[model samples]
Target: MTPSKRLLSLDAFRGLTVAAMILVNNPGSWARIYPPLKHAEWHGCTPTDLVFPFFLFIVGVAIVYALETKKIDISNHNQLLIKAAKRGAILFGLGLFLALFPKFNFETVRIMGVLQRIGIVYFICAAIFIKTTPRTQFICMTGILILYWILMTLVPVPGFGAPNLEKETNLAAWVDRLVLTENHTWKSAKTWDPEGVLSTLPAVATGLFGMLIGSILKGKEKPAAEKTTWLFSFGIIAWILGMFWGLFFPINKSLWTSSYVLYCGGLASMMLALFYWIIDVQGHNRWCRIFVAYGVNAITVFFLSAIISKVMGMIKVNANGEEVSSRTWLYDTFFTSWLPSDIASLAWALAFVLFFLLLLWPMYKKNLIIKV
Candidate 1:
């Protein structure tokens, strides 16, 4: 595939992932969310569980494509690494700002989060892609998966003195408490965090998996059709291994276990393969432009939509002589009144997606790419 075609497929895939994220995250009522949209209770895979990993995988793919030029010119290696670190720092800072918004509470602010993890993985993966050969990268990826499995399953928790995977008592959770502190961790589960420090090890593995595929995609030695077949085959093999590994490791998104990484990374690979086949290989592009629009300014919309939702929750208004959040008032008045409970929730979420689409359409038209 030519460079432009490869990018088109990637952008569309990323847009689809980000759009799914918005849908799952902003249902009108959390109480009314559909089963597929809700995250698994503890130790299973769900469609909703794939979104974050897919984003990270895309980040890995992006790093390979974005830094390939510098990879060739040895003189530019340090300059490229510096640029990657700066971008990573900005992404991490944005996540921190989001966590501290409207409260500015340093005392109890959640430090590790979705964007923060993305930033960290992106930084590490970018450096690896620039400095290492494909063989070395593959070995590193294998080592990370094996090492994380050992740490999580064999090593006993310090105070508990038992290898555990329980939500609060697990080794990852224990480290979160020791380092991030219980007070500064996730509020819902103060003793643990879904995006905690130790879990990030396997999260980086997830990105490496993508980086490997990206290296494959970037290779000129293979034809596009051959590359697609190999990627699809790899996806199937990795997915089956993940399911088998789940018996021992138990696929858990919160911990970002190795099994979870392989499972979701396989799914992401197949999805990207399909997009690449249809959009780039077949030269069919018009149908996927809406997703392209979402892709172009994905972080912008994701961040703005989150901030708007929170602000709406904070702003209260009088409705029927009772005070309620503006979000509640809008949902109750327009969505709940006409649609069934779950359907209304789904519809409200779709509206949020469309709202951003409309908001971003002009930007897409003007070719305003907001680089973050």
Candidate 2:
């Protein structure tokens, strides 16, 4: 494959994940979401659950294409480590910046986050990429999943005895709560955290899973259909194994349950294959263009949206003698005010995404790219 074709699919895939991330994150209201947009409560898979892992998988895939296309010299181990540390620092900083920006409260700031996970995973996976062959990476990936499974199930929480994929009593949650601050953890679960420390172990499997896809995509001789077929088959197999594992480990994202990792990673791998088939293989890329625009500059769009959302929220306005957020007003005026229900909310989000894309289209048209 030529350099261009190698990464086109990866870009589209990354863009797809970013588009979905923004869409779901910017929904009008969490309470009034379409079923597809909402996250699974626990121990189950959802479209949203696939988003982060998909991004991680895409990251791995791109790593292969990038290294091959650039012909990165791997003999220099120190050079590689330094590069990894720098990239990891940048990504981790971005995550922390996001967590603290517009409200930099040091006392109880978010310690772990999406970008933070990416940074750590990027460092570790990059090292693995340089040191191991694709086959070895695959073996290591599976090994990590299995090892995590055994560890989580056997390791006893301070007072809970063995690992529990339940609530605050679980080992992972306990570690995060003990190490991180009360306000620094995932706010949704109150006392517990979904993005806790121990959970990150299996999360690495998600990145390794991506690396496998990346290596597959990088294989010059492998036909697209063959690759896609393998993806589907492996996805089904992983899903089955994950389900069986879940019977013993339970598919909990909070714990980053080993089963949940395989399950989500499997689902993400399959989805990547499907998207590649549909958009690149089938040559159907029209609808995905807007998302592509957003995806190419994913960090830009995401950071902008968060900042803009915060700014809009801060600018409260008096409407009919009642306090109203400026952001809500914007959403209502353009998205929900006159639109019908059912899909009006969805449309509003789509519109928000589109409007945001307008800002990015220019950068894309100018061939400006943002990456850490």
lDDT, candidate 1, 6-28, per-residue tens: 48889899888889988998999
Compared with the true structure, what per-residue lDDT tens digits does model 2 show for residues 149-169?
777667788877877667777
TM for every model, in the order presented, reads 0.97, 0.90
- RMSD to native, candidate 1: 1.8
Clashing residue pairs, backbone N/CA/C < 3 A, model 1: none
Q: Please report the TM-score between candidate 2 and the true structure.
A: 0.90
User: Which candidate leads the pack in TM-score?
Assistant: 1
Ten residues in a row with the worst lDDT in model 2? 1-10
**lDDT for 186 (candidate 2):** 79
Model 1 gets an lDDT of: 0.89
What does the lDDT come to for candidate 2? Answer: 0.75
Model 1 per-residue lDDT at 303 = 85
